[model samples]
Target chain A: MSNTRMIELIGVQKSFGTLQVLKDISLTVDKGAVVALIGPSGSGKSTLLRSINLLTVPNSGYIRVGDHAMDFSSTQTLPRDRDLAAFRARTGMVFQGFNLFPHMTVEQNVMEGPVTVLGTPKAEARELALALLAKVGLADKAGMRPDSLSGGQKQRVAIARALAMKPDVMLFDEATSALDPELVGEVLAVIRSLAAEGMTMLLVTHEMAFARDVADRVVFMRDGCVVEEGDARQVIEQPSHPATQAFLSHFHNGLA
Target chain B: MQYQWDFGFLLQYKALIGVGVLYTIGFTIATAVSGLVVGCLVALLRLSHLRAATWVVTAFIEVFRCTPVLVQLVWCYYALPMLTGLELTPATAAFLTLTLYGASFYGEIIRGGIISVDLGQWDAGRALGMRRSQLMRRVVLPQALRRMVPPLVNQTVLQLKNTSLLSVLAVPDLLYQGQLITSASYRPLETYTMIAVIYFAILFPLTRLAHRLEARPGH
Candidate 1:
């Protein structure tokens, strides 16, 4: 497999008013690598994942994903809206809420990105959307509205919608966190298959076992910074940092 | 002699009433189309990040909505010609007032509809690499427009009724034509009753349609 830097964030910082969400964050993911970000709620894991696509631009930092790059501190070289749109196309985001255009059918939701952003022809986009929906195991539901889908099914469609763009990297912000316990499995299975196929993904997830199994590396975050990171097995099973150990204890006790 | 009934005279005035009805319907449709266009522009300006532009639109809506539509019609019909030295026919002045008046309400309804959409929808659009305009045209407008249907229909009915204000300017709208017939034939009771019936005939169905739209938001 050809390996190059797929994503890089250097000295990235984000704040909403006085509350800093991402503080001096620096990370890099090689092409085709999956990095799982695990943390307690409000620890900024999701914020960091969102910043990858400039969904929430950092207050100050340098970010580079593929050919797109931005130095937030520079006054003159700020990326234009078109540049940001192109960059976001390169790094697709799947939200926890699904956020599918409710007025559209499942097929339209899946095909929307390509038709509008890439200007792909209707026939080609339709074919790709159907294939992606099939990949997510919801090919039969393509004609239905988002309101009719199960929570897990909606998230899967959202994943397929993001994938339809054929992005260079995918970001999932707690994709399965909102699903009913019974429904979580189906969505995870699809994500697991994506991992198995060597898709580059960065996910903020609460499903510790799924992360450990699927992610090549896990980064534990606390209070807007990465406290620890290593190979997924080493980090999740035996942590060297006290913050990581403390955070894992809650999950360990609950699961055990 | 029982004050001789005069339903017979209306037969002679049917052409006038026909032209009047035509003008009424024409004014309503014209106001609606132009109002929608103006409303969208003002609504976008109100929602924009520009503080000064939003304040100006806010003032415009506030001014239109606070006063009676009569005040606006009178101003456009009377004061505007003096101040701007621009001449307008009485019917055109009525059209101008009705359009601006309807636009203020339309702008509010549109702004409300757009704001009510789930905030997460914007995130979905942005994440997909769509531009701001594409996001609005494709995602946000479709959902927002569905929700806006009831309010928009309600505004249309109200606007239709407000067109009667044109009678004051003697623009030969339905009410003005009825007044002319009543004066010429001295059959005020029958003439005004017929006018009332005609107004109800035009507007009652529209009100019912608005009710139906309100009841079934999915439509």
Candidate 2:
């Protein structure tokens, strides 16, 4: 991974009514880097990740992804829909739920972003979709509807759909969390291959082992604040903060 | 003295019955098509971010839905011309009333179907950088349309049934021609019974089609 900063967040904060979800969060990710965000349920990892694409607009903060940037605190009005869409096109996201368009076939699901957003020609988008499906190991299932696929297969198609846009970065919000235990491995394997190919990614995950194995950095958050962050192996294996250690203990006990 | 049933008198009125049936079918098709178009527009307005448009559309839908179709027909034919200062033929008034009435229900059904689509689908579309219109056309509507079919078909059947009220406006629909036949032959029993039978023929197939659509797997 290069040292050039790809994503930077400065004092990003978000609140919903009386509750503050993200508290002045600041972090940086380099090009080709994979960062795993590990935390408790209400730690705001997903919200933080979502804010990158302006999916959940932050109450106040500045987020810059490559050339596109948003300073939420500077403007009285929110960013224009056009600007938001342009910024979002830079990154791809995979939800816990596969969220495939049920009415579309697997190939159509993958081709949708390219054909609709990028305005790619249908024949070209079809080729790209086929290649993506093959990459995700679902080439034969192109014509099948999402309902007919297993959870693992659906998640892979979701991955392919996101990849069709040729995004600069990817966000995985507990992508494998909804899958059965056996199915989780296959989804993770696809993610692992992406990491090896040097795709920049930020993942909010409960998978501690995978975090240490695949992520270049691991950020531990709790109560809407970053508790500790460092090298993936160091943060996961030997956490310095009491909250981080306490959080890791639960996973250790569960695994045992 | 037992009364004798004269079944053969209706044969002479077949031309009148044919014209009535044609008018009934024509009104149903015209109103249904126009109503669906208006309904889609209403649903889109309701779903839009504009508060005033939403309020106006909501009021329009409620006004049409709360009042009876017969009252709407009478009002459109007799009352609307006075209010708007435009003369309307009986057929025109009947068409206008039925279209607006059907649109109210169609709009609600369409809105419900759209909102019923999972929120995650919206998220997925937004994440891919699709505009709201693009998302609706590419992702949301295709899925929503499947769930909307049975209800829409059901509403269309109701639309056809509503056309029966058109006879009060002298629009020459089946029931209106039946009245003519009754007055001419002095045989209300056979004429009205035949009218009901014709209505049954038209509506039965539509209802059955709706049921079949509803029963289809994976809906």
Candidate 3:
């Protein structure tokens, strides 16, 4: 693993019973690189994204992020809970449903990771949380509960919550897929800003235009395998693979 | 011929009835608290990955739930001493039986509440690098506690009513004192009517509180 490689997966394979979801998947993400993973519905995009943080543990694989590494095939016992938690603490994840803690205020939700996991003092965590919330354009919503926010506002809070952990890499699994068409822009704007700040991110997104504009590279997966991967503009505008061409045809007219 | 109603004789036994009321309320509060603690432990055990612990807790819940509270009180008071060779006073036996009986139902209610929280919420917490205990304390319990309030209150109310069965064990609860009043005064109608009134007075408000909690918005 090179110093520039922020995330590396080697011969990762995951299966659910008889059906394999990730087939010998090997990919590398460089530091400060934004990779957009796009594909059809059942193409294992979300599973692959979730595997990075060990949320959906692969059947047999090697996954390394930063200094933490786990090889599922080599170990008789699964990684200890403490080790897994420590590893996951290094990566931030945002979900499609905006799974914000409904019981806590937006500010508390953002402060939770730092105060609980990192053991940062409450006052310092509060300041950091406020800054993150402000960055997400939710400064006024600090005291409000998540259930009170709109889909767009909730997603922004979710983003702020994840970013509060100061993770090395951010994983967004269909972050904007569950939002209203009108609400998509606000969330996409936050992600776009994160990319501009050179945050290493892997996004499983259906937003073709947003991916084309913000991603440094595009990876196309189908049936648990990457069919095509190249420069974002090159792959989106002029595909070398026939499968990529067919997939891009559907979104051609919808591209903005 | 008209039956003349007389409530005047009961005034002489006011002090005794007052003591009975205090005993009943005390038992309810003590047992409710103990039951809740035991229930939480039971629920956690059931939720754990340990197959043996889960089976043991499930059996405990089933035994208490399937048997009648009256039978449980009798068995604890009478049969328990025979098996364990430790004699128990009426109050001790009643308290023990009620606490365990209440725990069985409370455990199920608490487990249901915890599981009712969305799977995504657990994922969200896990993704943030929270351990299972941290997720339960910081994420799952806070939300589950809201949905648990009404049922928990309702269960406590049932517990209060169940205290009436303590009379069979010769415990000096409200209903036991009422039986004494009936035998002494030879006025079963008035004594039973007054007992019913007192129970209603205590339970009506609690049931109302439960309803209000159930109707409360944003749960």
Q: Which ten residues in a row have the lowest lDDT in candidate 1 chain B?
A: B210-219
- Sorting all predicted structures by DockQ, with the top scorer first, yields 1, 2, 3
> Model 3 off-target regions past 4 Å?
B217-219
Residue A255 C-alpha lDDT in model 3: 87
Q: What TM-score, computed on C-alpha atoms, does each candidate reach?
A: 0.95, 0.95, 0.96
Prediction 3 global C-alpha lDDT: 0.94
The weakest ten consecutive residues by lDDT in model 2 chain B span: B210-219
Write one digit per residue (lDDT tens) for candidate 3, span A1-256. 6989999999888999999999989999999999999999999999999999999988888999988899998766778888888889999999999889988899999999998898999999999999999999999999998988999999999999999999999999999999999999999999999998989999999899989999999999999999999899889999899988988899999785
- CAPRI classification of candidate 2: medium
lDDT of each: 0.90, 0.92, 0.94
TM-score rank order: 3, 2, 1
Tens digit of lDDT per residue, candidate 2, span B1-219?
987877788999999999999999999999999999999999999998899999999999999999999999999999989999999999889989999999999999999999999999999999999887888898899889888999999999888888889988999999899998898889998888888899899989988888887875565
Show pairs that collide, candidate 3: none
Per-residue lDDT tens digits for candidate 1, residues A1-256, read: 1239888889999999999999999999988899999998999998999889998888899888877778886654546788888889988888899999988899999999999999999899999999999999999999999999999999999999999999889999999988999999999999899988878899999998888889999999999999999999899889999999999988875443
Docking category for candidate 1?
A: high
Give the lDDT of residue B149 in candidate 2.
Answer: 93
Q: What i-RMS does every model get?
A: 0.7, 0.8, 0.6
Candidate with maximal DockQ: 1
